[model samples]
Target: MNIEKFDSRFEILPIKEIIDENPTTKTFVFEYPLGGKPGQFIMMWIPGVDEKPMSVAFDDGKEFWVTVCKVGPASEALHLMKVGDLVGVRGPLGTHYNWGNGDHLALVAGGYGAAPMYFVAREAVKRGCKVEFFIGARSKDLLLYVDKISKLEGVNLHISTNDGSEGRQGFVTVLLDEVLAEGNCDVVFTCGPEVMMKAVGEVADKHNVASYMSMEKYMKCGIGVCGQCAVDDTGELVCKQGPVMDWKYLKKLPEMGKYHRDAQGTKHYF
Candidate 1:
């Protein structure tokens, strides 16, 4: 795959701090010039290993951040990067949430899904929209960013863990359903495993609320030219056309609940 368009690079900024989210997950905050939107992602390069897409966990222009769970080669390399170490970054790519039209916005996140949604919630608050966040993880150790997210204004935070280690003892979607049943949401946004997003989409559909979701797929090139990240029915190139898609339209995709192969050709089922 040709990755010329993905060649743009940012200086490797030193990591300022690392906060452990779980045994396998950590939030890395770095110093860098930033211009990213919520739901957008950055292509990170780990010196001789590989480059992968990561969502912006938080950013204040002068300082940028990402929450990475050590799941693979790229992520493990990211975990090894420490204070004052340089790491390559390239992008703020993909579409961001349009909080302009909504009055009450609800955000649903699962596991590392909270990374991108964190920025969305912050931006929504900045735009004067009331934001409610529902976050889920397999266990308490996997949940992250509670302290930081709690500080944002107008955010109603809800959490769930499968192991019942924190907050509610069920899935985050349960809380989402409850919130929707109360009929206070104008729009909904989500990012997580495809299955979780699909479930969230179903609830949003039932409530007739406009919804958007960030799709995660193996992306070799961050631009649209490569067909590596195509969506099921639409064949939409996620690199250029998405990562963020309207839930209503995404439901029409043929691969929604099926299976997809990872970068190393490992099959992952929804």
Candidate 2:
């Protein structure tokens, strides 16, 4: 793996604040000079520990934020980093969601999926698109960014939780069905668990709406060298070709749900 180092000065930003979204999830805000698109992600590095890919939750050009759940070694390290601690960031990489061409945009997000969609909704509203957001989590406490997304213009926010702890008790797909039954949308965009995205894709297909999905994979090198992140069917490199892909193109990947071997040759199901 020929990983290239970015020559620009990488700033070590302090953790400004952490907002607990759920018992297991928290939104961490950091201060950093930003230049990134809505769906792009940054490689977060913890010195002497590990690095992981995290999407920018929000950005004001000078400061940015990321919402993380304590899921693994890297995330655990991130959660332990204090307000004064330093963390390395290397990107804003991957293709961004296209909001310019769509007139009525429908965004479906689940779990931490809401992080990147928050930025996408902001940009869509800024571009004068009628944006409707359908967000879901396990329960009420798992939902994040409700207050912030609600304030954006032209955004119709709908909520759902599996345990009925908040808003609607059904899956987000139910709400999407209602929305589509009521009217039509120009495009549909989503980021979430693979099953969730696949479900959303089916609905969007039925509605004849253009759909886009942000595909998540374990990444080693953020750039396209390591071959660690390859899509099954088309063999496209997620780091180079996309973390975002058209729904139609993604469905064609041969290895979509087959065997994904890790560095140790351990097979994992997608």
Candidate 3:
């Protein structure tokens, strides 16, 4: 939970603004530094609703935002929230992705995974790194932040969708092959569904490029107190050791891409 920097307690803050990014997703802006790294997440509390771990889509030292997609009950509640409403926020938790200065970065994201990868690309450009950004979703309307990414000077943007609504057709990993083949990418950072991230890791391994992936699980506690987010074999807590993990760490997890646990700790295979 980045315990040294943030405590387990929730800090209540008003929704400074909300911007609809797509039909299914909206960005909630809060006027706080958050002090989150590119791949860090926060547990958001909604009083009677629930608190869910979400990625920090943007954090500019002064304010931060999280992009919420209406996928379930908790997310739906977030979508229903309006400006000036107060919401509880916890740590900018978990380990974050890392890269060297001026390195060429390969950033791949799927669906709402584009949110944090956008943060990665933005920060990378600021460090003078050349970025090759690949964003994927089900269709054109589902793709997030492509316009803003295109405007970034050092970024070369690419898009892919499952139904070919825009850009190339098929999985975003298909485009990763081309970017890695160029032999300029220093590392690959990806997020989204576990299966997609597993595939991204495999591609990175094939190219012998280092890779880091963001993972999600059904967790009751954003802190390590609840073991719900622990992975197979090593028992590394996703709420602590990860949310972001390199291929070396993730490849050892027996359940990677195969199954995940529900809130009740029942295994659900993909």
Best by TM-score: 3
Residues 5-57 of candidate 3 have per-residue lDDT tens digits of: 54578899999999989999999999997899999999999879999999999
> What are the lDDT figures for the candidates, one per model?
0.85, 0.82, 0.92
- Give the alpha carbon lDDT tens digit for every residue of 70-92 in model 1: 88888998888778877788888
TM-score of 1: 0.92
Who is ahead in TM-score, 2 or 3? 3
Candidate 3 segments whose C-alpha is farther than 4 A from its true place:
1-6
List clash counts for every candidate, in order.
0, 4, 0
lDDT of 2 by residue, 129-159 (tens): 8988999999887887888898998999999
- What CA root-mean-square deviation does each model show from the true structure? 3.0, 2.9, 2.1
Of 2 and 3, the candidate ahead on lDDT is: 3
lDDT: worst 10-residue window of model 2: 256-265
- By lDDT, rank the candidates, best first: 3, 1, 2
The true-versus-predicted C-alpha distance at residue 204 of model 2, in Å, is 0.2
Ordered by TM-score, highest first, the candidates read: 3, 1, 2
